[model samples]
Target: MAKASRRKSQSFLHGALILTASVLIVKLIGALFKVPLTWVITEDGLGYFNTAYNFYGPIYSLATAGFPIAISRLVSESCTRGAYRDIRRIHRASAPIFIGTGTVGFALMVFGAAAYARIIGNESALPALYTLAPAILFSCLTAIYRGYYEGLRNMYPTAISEIIEALSKLTVGLSAACLILHRGMKEYEALGTVFGVAAASRDYARSAVLPYAAAGAILGVTVGSALSFLFLFCRHRLLGDGITEENLKNSPPPRSMRKTVSRLVRTAVPIGVGAMAVNVAAMVDTTFLQTRIHNVMEQNPQVLLSMYQGMIPQINIEAHTVPNFLFGCFSMALTLFMLVPAVTQAFGISALPNVTAAYTRGEKTHLKKSMEAVLRVTALFSIPAGMGLAVMAGPVARLVFGARPSLPITSHVLVIMGVGAIFASFSTPVNSMLQAVGRVDLPVKLLAVGLTIKVALNYFLVGIPQINVLGAGAGTLACYFFLTVAALTCLCRETGILPDFLSIFGKPLIASILCCAAAWSARGLLSHVLTENLSTLGGVGAAVLVYSLSLLCLRAICRDDILMLPNGQKIAKILEKHGWIR
Candidate 1:
């Protein structure tokens, strides 16, 4: 029994590693595309993109209704039951629900874009708002398709689709902005006009020079992406004929449509609520803090909101969302992407089946042992990744925000947020483990409590004068810390598979400490070279290299750890060939 639990841990790790590699590509594409988009739209226009996105994101989540989460659980359970055919049917049945709901969600986003801009971003923002409204359709469809494929234990399609989505969005969004630039409008002004809507106190004079070039680039991309997803749906019709024939021959006496719908609704609602509760911080933080941070920078209070809305999320997405998309779609939704496949792919191919056998037998000792292996494996990856972000927070913030974009408030917030990320990262695997074990409701309660604390803390922190945005970051850290402890405890209590407490807590702090030292040292080393054109690039390279080496040398992560990933063999082959290993 214990070994089976270990197998799940290994499986989760394998998923996470594959996801990391795939996610890296997705993040790169997202960053590359958004950079030009940001240049075109201007910081203020970026605000509009954020506003439209915020308005639709929650809806998108609601439409998804935890489809990926529910699908994965269902599929895994079926696999456990050896009902392979049913797992396929479950995936097929779920997609239309997502599509139908997603279509309505997209329409709502389009209709509400202007209103959202005025209410959330600024009255002067209309261009960015409208331009990004269509993004919702593309984004939602992309997610649904990926989720469907992931439920089937396929990762490549999801990975490819994410990269394609980023490529499409970038190609379309930027090409449209570039046409404005071709007209001789400066980059900032052209982009502002493109993504920023016409609002009160609008600066029309700045945009007057550029001819209106709608439907050619950005809009076309949006339309094309929607069409592409429709094309994928077309293949389903072709595939459906075969699927229906197979199902008629093999399916358990045709369940009533009402029963299927009711089953999906019942399972998905809880997952959706839990998913939403965890992410509530993203939607609420800006709205609550925007009014208060106004005093600190009355002339441009939107700075903090912009950072949270446009900047921080955009940066974090490279690490989280794009990876999430890649993992969810191709790797095995978020849970498998983040945990199972990566670990299995890394540690040992035989590890998972052995663990699974142990779990099947319900050997409590083996489960503990398997969890121990998982704890060790998770750290080998997380310690380095989390530390890299924490230590290099300043450089990362500088690179992401651009050299001059890091104000005292912004600078401090980025570093502090990295502090929060360390805790949040660990909590993720723990939460996923609970979901995998079919204890979904437990995570929901934990997340609800943490979110409530975060919200309450944000209000109190925002009231303080000097703390300002730092308070928001602090609140986030508090939330994650609370969740990590609570979730870890709950999982241990329920399963009796107590993970290595030291690996969980001690490693993150050590990684953070190493990160801080390496980052500060790199900053000192790069201080002379960092200025004007070279600052962001120079600082980032130095910090990344330094932090990475420090972690390896300190044994925080090394050859053995690398061998634990799905990609471990390749890594091991390279290292051993190079004599980095015996």
Candidate 2:
């Protein structure tokens, strides 16, 4: 029994590390994809693309979010019990349900794309919306297969599919956008427009060109998702044929379709709602925040128009670009990259089996310990990463995106959003824990409370012209902070696991602050001796070194913490030999 438990723990760690590495690679490739995309499409074009995405976010979540998790949970539980036949039953039962929801989602996006775009205050986004509509169905199909593989304790397929999807998006999306822009440029030249001109003409040129380019860029989403579905479908057929054959030989008669769907809906609702909560908040921003800004501009157009005349270039650039691009960087760079892997990426998925096993066995002590350890591991990674990201936002953005006119605001928002990243990371593991423990519904309820607060904050803050983007970041911070606190409180109450807040969070916070200070000073000093980009890079290198050494000095994290990381054993042994583990 002891050996089995130890092996399971090792397997858990191994899977988590693999998933983490894959997710990090995917994010890096995604960032690489976005940088050149931003250059090709520009901020204005990105605005339309983002608008289409924001509108699509919730519906896509509805289609894909719950079913995968529900299926995974059902499948994993059966696998744990050696009920291979039940696993087949569950997958067979889920197929029709998945297809139905996915179809509905696809239809909504395709048929309602025009109305959705117009209602969101960007009729120009309709082309992008239409182009991206098929992604809903494609993504949904991929999710069901991915969930099945995940339940079987496999991560490679999902990881490989993600890489393929990113590659496809990068290759196809960029090519399409460039081609569209080239055509647009030809059209403008034929119409007697000069290449090198004043800001006014450039603004006009962009208005005519960017919409088509944005649509072309968004079409890549549909293409990539379709390819991902194909990859997963083939992989599933290849790997599961023998299992399917065996299951069919021993399988019971099919359950009633109504009963199967009822079970699926019951399982999917909470997981789906919880999973989609963040996207829902983003949709709220898209629906309300953008319209509010438009209203503010309209009410004071004369004043704004006069102000723009003196700063024509800056105004033109900002007028078209700032909102969408800024939000994308915040969502992708900080939210997806900096925060997600801590818990939601692979950690949560890996935890499902152990957590569910312990909970199902009614091993209260084991479950509590498992939950706390997960939380601690999450904090050990997320806290310093968040702080480092905040302080290094400017340099990081410049490195990734190059210096653009809107960069200062983008960097500022990134810093502010970094606070949200900490809380967001915290929320994911806790939510996952809750789901594993069968209190999945609570997270959705708690998220609702947070979303209400977020909406209120965004309404007031985003309306202020000076605090426009910053306000959105601030709202995100507050929303996630509320959810984190709420989730933690509920988790402890239910599990009788009061986490050592000071040990898990406080030490890391202190060390990270010190690291940030050092990083800040390094950036200032390096700037005097090198170009801004080079200086930022130097400062980042210093930050990493300082933070790692500081962790050892403060003992914020120890041998156990290091051992949780990939290549952890060798690294821990070296640290121990060096007297760094104490």
Candidate 3:
């Protein structure tokens, strides 16, 4: 029994690390894809792209968010009880739910693309919206397999499939966008028209081509989802989940499909609602940022324009595309902000099954240990990363985006968002733990209040000429901060387990502050001798070094945490030999 328990714990940690590594690779590929795509489509074009993307988020969440989690939790619980047949049943029951939801989501995005575009006041985003719609169906299709594998404590399939998706996006999406842009430019230069439409000016010609270019880029995302689904489908058929014939024979009879579906739906709805709330917040940001900025332009144009003097282009103003242009700049900062959460989100996904298994077995000690480890690891990564971004926002922004006119705004927004990213990153794992422990409804309730607060703050602040889009960042910070604290409190209350707050949050906080100070000083000192990009790299390197050392000195990571890694026993011996860890 002890050996089996030890193996399960190791599997959990290995699964998390596998997903984390994949996230890093995916984010790197994403940076390569998005940074250059930004240059190709420009910020104005990106606005159209992002506008469509924001609209897609909630629908995607609605279609697929809760079911995978539901499937995972059910499979984990059944696996814990040694009911292997139920695992297979859970997977079977999930298929129709995903297919139905995906179909509905795809149809909605296709038919309702125009209305969403009109409501957001960016009619140019329609093509991007339409092109991106097919992804919803495919992604929903892919989610079932991801959830099933994750539930079985296998991370490789999920990791490999994600890499396949990212690579496809990078190769297919970027190429298509560039091809469209190059062809459009060639046509304009030779014929004074873009794609047979008369262009009064070069600027107008480029503007006319941007929507299609954004759509072309979106085409890659759709293609990637389809390909990812194909990979998961083929892999599942070729390599059946490692359930043995003996295990299935020993298992108790599986529940009827009707009961299984009912149970899955009951588990899924609250979790789905919680997940949808997060995406709906993004949708809210998209709708309000554009409309409020548009209102500001209508009612107090000079006040807002004066705040961003020379940054808002004349062409954008003439085309009434100022909202999207500004949103695009915000989105640029958002690209970096999302990377931290994306990594932690993997932690959340990896935690759900392990935590569910522990809780299902009524293993109180193991549950608390799992909870603390998840929180500690999340803080250890998120705090330093978020603070580093805040401290080095300008250098990092300039490094990735070059000298675009929007850099100043993007940098400023990133500074605020960097701090917000910490709380945002924390919320994912916390919510996952909550769901794991059976208080799945708490996250939805907490998110509802938090998002209400965020929306109200955004509406009030974004309208202020001086605050403008920075208001959105402030709202994100407020929303996630509240969600993190409240959810943590709720998790403790529900579980009757008081996690060591200092170990989980304090030591990391101290280390992160020192890390940020090191980064700031390093960047300042290196600027004299190094190029901006190189200096930024130096600062980042210094920050990482300082943060790692600080954790060791403070013993922020416990021995058990170390032992969860591959060959952790040998690594722990080395650390203990040096008295670096207890």
Cα TM-score per model: 0.73, 0.89, 0.98
Candidate with the greatest lDDT versus the true structure: 3
Cα RMSD (Å) between model 2 and the true structure?
4.7
lDDT of 2: 0.72
Write one digit per residue (lDDT tens) for candidate 2, span 1-582.
011111022345566777777777777777777778888876667767777887788888888758887776776676666566666667777777777788999898888878766665667778888898888888988988877767766777778988888888888888898998887677566764524432245457766677788888887778999999999887666555235444445555655656666777897898888778778887776766566566556665454334334322454435543344444444434433344444455777776766777788789887766776677667767887777777788787777777765566567878877767878887767887888778879989999899998898888887776665567778888998899999989988887777678877887787778778888889899999899988887887787788788877877655655676668899888988878774
In candidate 3, list every pair of residues with a backbone clash. none
> Where is model 2 poorest over a 10-residue stretch in terms of lDDT?
1-10
Best by TM-score: 3
Q: Report the lDDT tens digits of candidate 3 across residue range 1-582.
A: 011111132256777899999999999999999999999998988888888888898999999859988888888888889888898899988888899999999998899899888887899998899999999999999999998888888888899999999998999889999999989989999999999999999999999999999988888899999999999998888667878777888999999999999989999999999989999898878888898999999999988888788888899999999999999999999999999999999889889988998888889999999999899889999999998888888889999988877789999999999999999998989899999998889999999999999999899998888898999999999999999999999999999999998878999999999989999899889999998899889999999999999989998878888898899999999999877775
1 or 2, which is superior by TM-score? 2
Q: Among all windows of ten consecutive residues in candidate 3, which has the lowest summed lDDT?
A: 1-10
- Point out where model 3 deviates above 4 Å: 1-10
In model 3, how large is the Cα lDDT of residue 247?
A: 81
Model 3 lDDT on a 0 to 1 scale? 0.90
